[model samples]
Target chain A: MAAAAHEPEVIRDKAVMRAWSRCRRAEGKAVALVPTMGFLHDGHLSLVSAAVAAAAGPVAVVVSIYVNPSQFAPTEDLATYPSDFAGDLRKLAATGAVAAVFCPPDLYVRGRAGHPAAGASGGAVSCLEDAGGHAHETWIRVEQLEKGLCGSSRPVFFRGVATVVSKLFNIVEPDIAVFGKKDYQQWRVICRMVRDLDFAIEIVGTEIVREADGLAMSSRNVHLSCEEREKALSISRSLMNARTAVLNGNNHGQQLKDEIVQTLKEAGGQVDYVEFQSLTFSLD
Target chain B: MAAAAHEPEVIRDKAVMRAWSRCRRAEGKAVALVPTMGFLHDGHLSLVSAAVAAAAGPVAVVVSIYVNPSQFAPTEDLATYPSDFAGDLRKLAATGAVAAVFCPPDLYVRGRAGHPAAGASGGAVSCLEDAGGHAHETWIRVEQLEKGLCGSSRPVFFRGVATVVSKLFNIVEPDIAVFGKKDYQQWRVICRMVRDLDFAIEIVGTEIVREADGLAMSSRNVHLSCEEREKALSISRSLMNARTAVLNGNNHGQQLKDEIVQTLKEAGGQVDYVEFQSLTFSLD
Candidate 1:
């Protein structure tokens, strides 16, 4: 069959999506979704590349552009998460992506409209406690994947990721979804979720895209100062060192972790966390 | 504006949904979705009624027909739940439903493949621990709503409802999705989920449609014995008594619960749970 046409790039609402599906059925084309938060970097591009390669037919890569508020902690840089829609679109186009950017607001808060009680407007918002009746009491909790690593530091982070990713998977309805492996825990958690929920879409974890100096490309990289950027290279370097150690028969979990932590500290990098567990076997 | 032509109901795969979106935009019509499992009843019909009433243009009620395994507990009757596609379609047609049912086994199982060792044979399994990895790892936790009523008896019930409902919402992409309040907690949880997740679609909760004798129409009602059917009337009767007590200046929480429990027992019915909580002035 001939390849499907890729004229319509941006689909905002559900109606457009339905029509898109109808046309694809006529052409026997497949869609690949690359969900992102709009600040497209090399890491995101890597996911797009993976999506393009994995799709069997004409691909429709939907990059959801919303910087989800639920995923961010109150103390985190939610308000200042970098967003470059124009730049993101140009980057996506450069990759020959037949992708639509879906960007929505952070808060779609709705109520019967009687306003808040008194002057409680400008207080420090406790995201967990203040959710009160405002947030849907329902939350997606991924057990083992969420208990360690980033979940240790940011308690609510994976819950937010699981929920948002679930929403995107539902909205985009892609044959395959590409996620960068740099957020290894997130990728694992999402994979677990997809398997648990039985979302038909195949989740492809793209290899970590790196900078010239070997630092993993992250949106948060923009937050690092010149010196911090130089120091951040240690994080990737430490992982490489750990990998080398594992290859050289250093299979002891604690030994590999200790070596990586020592290397990072030596390189002037603040160690967030460094731990090793058997890849195939359960830690417990 | 003229009403858009209703497209013939077509079951589109994940790849097709994207293409369908683009085609609809070209045709100048928005898509509205109403999601339902097969085995249609008045409860589901009520949601379709709401969807048709709220839709602006060509509406597509993508009835996802899948008996989701992740939602059922091991002890619950997952195998026995009713499913009738022909009968459901007939009902859909009566409700002016314009779209095809988006039934996919994997779509129904969205978020369920946590245990890699379990493999593909894990079909239609319950959330029992021994059922292995195909058993649900992620659950939608609803706080207060899950504290009383049916939740007490069926611990995994609302979680299953929320997860499946979420999957349906994502797959259908409705502008206005309808839900029947027969599953009152389900309706409330979904409303909260849509708001919390910033889903653009409007959630319309339809009032419960009951049998002539007042027992809520449920797919499980088919499993009830003739004698059990007569006994089930006590559930509604107990609810009515509780409502009457609250209306008669019964402000004490314990007293209201006690009265409801007593009324149910007096009517030769097993009391699952009776709970009372202060209704927020603002939520009202």
Candidate 2:
């Protein structure tokens, strides 16, 4: 209860974060970690609220704000991923839900202790380059879960996600963790990874948060031109239409996807993928 | 310390080991982990003693006994690898220097919670196959370090070692880890992995242990025939000669290797490799 009202601690280094978290854990506090690429939209904040609701018995909610470079392709928006560290902290502080904020400066740029053999270049290699690029050696993958859907279009996406999440889990050592179902496939990938790796942490998947216009909240939405933004609305709108149709006894899977695709295509949207499955995505 | 006098606890599950280690860590007790495949030898016990000697201020020493199959090549000796669980426990008990033994049944099998998408196979496939061999998608590699020495002959060796050790680090949550220099390349690979990954633990490399006959003690030594074992002694004999040559100021790298190669050749021993480098082996 004190943590909810207390001003959340701002931690920049992983070492400080670990010491803080470990101390709280020793006090029998149940910690829930919310990992985010920050630029606090309503979506990220809603995840915090979900963590709060899920928190029980001396719970401390911690949110990590990191724009992981490994997750973005060189041509993709690595340079453009939004950030406002002061703004994020202010918003998190306003919520009165977070107990601590973990904002590591260089999550991907590992230690500068260059391999003496690497000479001038050191061991600081780009993680995504050829095998010789970076010295980073560990990765976690949920094979089947990362294969379908956005996986095909963004091949390196889930590998980057899983690797970073695994590091976060190791760094934070939280008892419970929260992720958004908006990135539905990612949620499944993470859940499967946690289960397979025996991480001993509970994973909570929060529902998607949307604006009054029914568009899902995302930091990237801010960069869209007005016309492009209107067209982007079709993406979420199509999902809503399919859900309504299914609720109205339209149990035909192919027919539902066909209708949604048509609506998105009319709005000049490219439907990358559409999938429906049981919540857990159990392979058996 | 009380830990040094008490009989070492034998832990078979990952969950229990984590909780036990976490509790001690929270109490400010440092933990030193030594991971090994079972069938303990004096070399293994020496690793334990190093861990004990290095542990400071309420130390807990943990040794994980798991024969990781993923590290062995299919044609190599996975089935023939030695195991004596009871004998290993007895040896560790005799040391009175170990606090716990973590012997998991399946270090690489992962969870049986099969994914539904993999058709009939689910996630039950073996960890080492072609690209589509199994559903396990995680791996750790120390590119430059794994390239030389036995790594060239045994390509999958370092990958398997890095992965399983990473898992053990996550599971045991030790403060310090000790490795043997007898596994010279393996030691370097692990050091690079820990540094590159920012594991937040100290790695101590212990001196290589040898028998009175100058044979390096290994679990696999049990499989050698008497004549074969006698020839094996030549391997160490050449190494001791090489060391003496270097110490006696034989600075010519090529000349020393040429002489050593001829010695092993005369003894009817096929030398796998001979590497001389600065300790770090940076490939700049």
Candidate 3:
């Protein structure tokens, strides 16, 4: 725990990161992973602490800070996504929980070794064709879980998330991984993925960290004006109200979803969707 | 070489297989993998031998024998696929190359721990939902490479191949994997997948193993009648003719394909497809 306060090593190469994890594993030490985009916030740090606490024995924590391009669509904020490499490092260092920062500039390096463009720096091309007419064509998908939520609007979102996470799991080779439940579907999709793929690592889902004023902490919160931020509060409020309603014996899923959608619309929020899938849905 | 002649230990559990490979790795030994769908022929043995020859140092060769159900469709011959586990083991033992055989009855268990069906033995459900309403939803796809050849006819084939192979790689943690070029498109798809996914393992594609009559060795060959077997000879002959034509100044891709198709048709062989993809296509 004392070594956790030191400056974390920033690993830019995939091989180096993998070797670091492998070395830790070889030493009979557990490696905990917290995957994130660069602009680290309290929610991200909470996931890091969650990873640290979740480890049973002495553990080496790795925080991957790549802003994965595969998880973003062309129309999305991929180009405009906020980043602060230096600030992120300082934040992680402040957490006193992280051991290393795996800030690989590009995880999706095209055509490494086998293809025609083997050594060329074909960096971070999405699942689509790169400028060189070549592409990183392999993708991982969680078919059933990825559907209905964000998958409906962002057709390529879950595929991107699943693929990049698979890359991280393979490279980091962590004993356990932590994900924030703010992105509920993503966390479930990943849990399903690790299970289906037979990844030996355990998946830890942590609760979403929210601001004192009740808004969930997100990097995109920086983009919102005060008025927009106030309007976004309705999302958490409606969810709390729905929970209260469910506790009060109003157990209809569709009715709660309709109420939440109406609440968001009334609060001047543009509601893309409001879905409720039963967590207790029996597989049997 | 003495270790090679010892009977290969059969491994069925995923955890045990991972432990076997990890222990070998910890001892500074390389583990090579040869994946097959049972009913092993000389072709599969050749691949096991190639894995032995490919290693620079002492290596533990692992062969996985599973008839993956995800790659086959409901309309396809999933149930009818040939399998001979006992015979396959004898053939591999005779080769004196394989160190271990990973023959898991099912890799796609519906849920291990996170799902409602945890520890329920919901075995080997394809991408589709099972009778218990649970499924293994995760899948891997080599998009561009899988598009043209067998992918065209069997839409789910390469995704199945890519996904299952990924499971094997994660479980076996092999230093290198040997794939036979008899499934030419499959080999290419897997190579592309390993490159794109940043898997540390190496993929070695071995040449197609042919019988004395020049027919590619396949498990399905047992189903062929004498006349059907004679007609199948046209496939390898046409490929040889096309190669000869290419060497003799017939560099036109489509022209060679047309000639091959014509030859197969003339020999009363029903041609599903005859096409060419230039392996030398420059990514630049």
Each model's total of backbone clashes: 36, 7, 0
Give me the displacement of residue A204 in model 2, in angstroms.
1.4
Model 2: per-residue Cα lDDT over A1-284, one tens digit each: 47446578988888888888888888889888999999889889988888877767778999999887666655678777788988998899898889999988876543334343231111222334422334465544556677778877776678778878877887788888999999988998898777656676899999999988888888988898999888888888888887787678667777777777898899988778766676213311
Question: Can you give the lDDT of residue A229 in candidate 3?
Answer: 91
Model 3, stretches more than 4 Å misplaced?
A1-5, A110-134, A252-255, A279-284, B1-5, B110-134, B252-255, B279-284
Sort the predicted structures by DockQ, highest score first.
Answer: 3, 2, 1
For lDDT, the strongest prediction is 3
lDDT by residue (B65-174, candidate 3, tens digit) is 99887777556777788988899888888877778999998887654443443111113233333224457778787767877667777777787889899989889989
Task: Please report the candidate that would top TM-score against the real structure.
Answer: 3
Ranking by lDDT: 3, 2, 1
Please state the CAPRI-style docking class of candidate 2: acceptable
**lDDT of candidate 2 over B1-284, digit per residue (tens):** 46456578988888899999988787778989999998999999889888877876778899999888667766687878899988998889888778899998876543334342232112222235422335555555566677778977777788778878888887898999999999999998998777666677899999888889999999999998998888888878887887897778767777767777887788787778777767224311
Give Cα distance to truth, residue A78, candidate 2, Å: 1.3
The superposed Cα distance between candidate 1 and the true structure at residue A202, in angstroms, equals 3.5
TM-score of each: 0.68, 0.86, 0.89
lDDT of 1: 0.65
Expressed as tens digits, the lDDT of each residue in A1-284 for candidate 1 is 74334322766765465456446645666777777887889888888778888987776666667776656666877778898888887787777765566665542343233433121111223244333424344456676678777877776678777877776655555678888877889998999887665566789998888888898888878889998888777788888887786678665776667777887888786777876645424221
